[model samples]
Target: MNYVILGAGPAGVTAAETLRSVDSQASITLVGGEPEPPYSRMALPYLIYGKIDEGGTYLRQDPTHYDQQRIRYVTGRCGGIDSRAKELYLSGGEVIPYDKMLIATGANPIMPPIPGAHLEGVETCWTLEDARHILKLAEKGSPVVLVGAGFIGSIILEALYLRGCDITVVELAPRMVARMMDETAGGMLGRWCEAKGVRVLTNTRVTNIESGPEGGPRLSVGLSIGQRAPADLVVMAVGVRSNTGFLVGSGVKTNTGITVDDYLQTTAPDIYAAGDCCEGVDLSTGKPDMLAIQPVAVEHGRIAALNMAGHKHRHRGSLNMNVLDTIGLISSSFGLWQGAQAGQTAKVIDEGGYKYMKLEFEGDKLVGAQCVGMTDHVGMLRGLIQTGFRMGGWKDKLVASPERLREAYISVAQGGAVGGADVAARQHAACRVPWRGERSLAF
Candidate 1:
């Protein structure tokens, strides 16, 4: 059996490994457009902050490891795919035929239409090369202008802060990470960035960019109030879109990305799609959602491999669970929030100092939750939500009383059939409050 994967990103790598595990004698070949081997896309900002060495970003095993596993990797760009011929056309005029193929092409950063965007010192931090370029420019203490206030832009702020570079963030939206979090949570994160010495300009757009008088480049950013600011280096951190251009007219149906069924199989037989370049349904909303997260990609790869290996595993769909660590501020949100649902009930608890907990419940089950500031127990909460826990008829009652809340949560975590009111009473009796009213409640 011949298995050919069209990318070297997380999804492709995992698919290759899974195939090898299931069928040892299968001939596996991984092709990548990047000259370098696979690297952690999530670790790009860490590389920029000098938190990890450059070599640490590489995801591929050493030459000896690949030799032992009998996995062949081809470094080249894929020009197009011939689904009928079962071959991939390479940029270097080479054709690789495959019996089974997995397309994990991933995504590319979206560069907006702005004048002088082709100027030097303007770049996007999507790849290792982009990170290296930004790092080299940072050493010169250049004034940096970062466009977009999404996850990438926020993390880049921390990285540039460690380098002691002057950064001015220009976001067209009123808040940062608008797609991931609500306006209230976004405001809290914005304040945290401000406290850390980042000049965040909201409702601002870059109209044009031009060469500076001396050496560096200058960007003309338009403000909502009608003003302009000069910038030296511009880093565009706008969101990314799926890379499915090569699949066009190849008989593989695609909307925003390559369309795949629950089994991860594309329109063509024996062909599959995964990672950022594929679109799947959301479990909660039952709507088609393209969640380009690493975990989702990894799971998609595993499911695709299972199906290719003649197994009966199906992808259960993905959720929008965003957990981010910006400096020391921890922020996370799962499912949908208030105002996001038309007829949902919401309960909010604000402890001040930028800490908050908001829960949106449709009935007995938790539809969504948002936790910001001092998030130590967010992992536990996120897990509960993912597992689809039902709070019975005690949801509203427990949320209203602080004492009952701990017991209700613990009961749900242990298994929904555990004792309810008795457990709540016992735990509340043992509960102790500290001077700051922030003591551990062991329920």
Candidate 2:
């Protein structure tokens, strides 16, 4: 069998490896748009902070690992897909045919429509090249004006803070990471950033950017209360959009992202989609969501590959889980919060800075949870939610007594709310244990 996987990021690479494990003789061709090998996108901020060298960020396998695994690596951009011919048209005029194709094109940073955005020193931190350029600018003491206050932007703030770069974040929202956290959690993070000497301007918009004194860039930021601020370098971390332009009119259905069934199969037979370019159904809410996180993408790739390899595997979708490590502060959220209004109830326990736990319950069943600060119990709590634990008469007691949360989980598991087929299904959903018997699934 011949398999061609587009985009050599985590999802594509994992799909290739998984396919190899199932059918050792299957010819695999991995095409990457970027010239460099696959690297950790999460570590880009550290590169800017000078915490790790450029070479250290490359998350590649051994030099000859792909060769030994019989995987062909093609470094080029895929212009389009010819579903009728079962071939991928490359920008370099190469046609790669495939019996099975996996589209893991991932996402690209959304650059807002602002004047002088094309100017020098204004960049997006989406790839290693972007990180390298940002790092160079940071080393030269560039004054940065970040456009968003999302997780990536917050991490960049911390990174530049460590590097002593003058950064002014202008977020249009009222608080940082508003989509990921509640106002209370966002407030805590904002305070943390302020303490770290990072100037976070929330409820503000960047109207224009022009050349500053000494030919540097100056950003004209418009605040909600009608104000402006000027700065040098501009880093746009607005958000990301799925990379599915090349699949247009290729018979692959896409709404926000390439829509895949529970089996990860696209509208076209023998073609599958995963990662940031694919939108999966939310298990908790039963709605389609483009949750562009690394862990979810890795799992999508694995599940897609399993079904592609003739294994009866179904993707149970993803929960809205976010875990962020920013400047020694641990913030994590799973399921719904108090204000989400998902027909779910929540109980919040805020104990100063040491710990914060919020449990979201749908009647007697545990639906979701959010934990900020120290998260020693987050793993277990997340597992209980994913397994569909039912608290029944013990819901209030569990919330009242922190010590009994674990016991409540034990009772729910033993009471068959998370047993039998449900346990097997949960195991399948969490089974990142690569079928190839790999020691770890880091990729």
Candidate 3:
């Protein structure tokens, strides 16, 4: 069997390794667009923070990891695909034939439509090349303008902060991480950054950018609010879309991303899609949804490879989850964190203490949850929501005292027996601040 994977990121790499393990005699070829060895894009920020060197970003430490596994690693740009012929055309004029193909090409960073966006100093921190360029420009105390405060932008903020870059974040949303975090939580994060000496502007957009006059940064950024800031470097972290351009006429369907069935098989026969390039089923909504996180990508890879090897595995779909650490403040959201229709919600807010937790319930089962600073019990939230654990009587108890979540999780998720008396004592020990509840799932 000949297997060809379109990408060498987590998804494609995992698929290749799994294919080799499942069918040892099968020929596997992994193509990566970048020149560097398969490296984790998540580790790019750490590279800028000096926490790791270029070698540290590599996915496989040993040079011969691929060779030992009998996986062919090819570095080339994919020009297009011929689904009818079962061949992949490289821009360099190479055609690779395959019996089974996995499209895990991942995603490309989105560059917003702003004037002078293609200027020299403006870059997107998506690859090794971008990181190298950013490191050179975003030197210590250099003025850096970050155009988005979403997950990627917030992550890049940490590295910029550690590098001593005078950073100013401009987010078009009303709050930071608006997609993952609720208004209150997002506001808290914005305030947290400000407290840490980072200028955060919410509900703002970069209207224009031009060359600076002289003796300063090479660029001047104009804001929607009629403000001008000189920036040595502009990092566009707006967002990303699936890398599905190569599949335009490949007979594979795409809607926001490559549409794949539960088996991760694309519309084309013998062709599968995985990672950020495909829209997998969403567990919470039970619908096709795009989850670009690395965990989902890896999971998609394993399941797709198994099916490709004739194991007949089916992916149940991925739960939307994001855990972000921005400038020492930890925030996370899972499932329909914003709340479901007609869902009962409970929240504990301690802004002065920098702690908050919100639980959304759909008839006694945790459908969504959001938290900041209450990191110890976060895993439990994910567990209860992911497993669809039936809280039963504990639901009301949580509404009364959400801080005693540890007790509830131990009793239900862990299948432990804790008396009600113990629960009361733990509740009292946990927190004294009474939480507020609302029947309406209002914003």
Give the range of the ten consecutive residues with the poorest summed lDDT in model 3.
Answer: 434-443
What order do you get sorting by TM-score, best first? 3, 2, 1
Task: Work out how many backbone clashes candidate 2 has.
Answer: 0
Candidate 1, 1-443: lDDT as tens digits: 99999998889988888888889999999888888777878888889988887667877647455557777988888888888899988989999999989999999999998888888778899899899888877754667888898877887877887887777888988898888778888898888888887788887888777776665345554445566555666888888999998887788899998889988899988899989999876656767678888877887888788788887666766666777776677888787754245434445556357876777666667667777774655655554455566777667675675234456666665543556676666445434421111223321
Name the candidate, 2 or 3, with the larger TM-score value: 3
TM-score of 3: 0.93
Ten contiguous residues minimizing lDDT sum, candidate 2: 434-443
96-214 per-residue lDDT for model 3 (tens digits): 99999999999999998999999999999999999999999999999999999999999999999999999999999999999999988998999999999999999999999999888
Could you tell me which residue pairs clash in candidate 3? none
lDDT of 2 by residue, 303-390 (tens): 8888888886777767678887666778887766543454444455564563566677777767777666856656666666666655
- Regions of candidate 3 where Cα sits further than 4 Å from its true position: 418-443
**In candidate 1, which residue pairs get closer than 3 Å at backbone N, Cα or C atoms, i.e. clash?**
none
- Each model's lDDT: 0.76, 0.77, 0.90
What local lDDT does model 3 show for residue 9? Answer: 93
Error of 1 at 298 (Å): 0.4
Winner of 2 and 3 under lDDT: 3
Model 1 residue 180 distance off true place after TM-score fit, in angstroms? 0.8
The estimated TM-scores of all candidates read 0.89, 0.89, 0.93
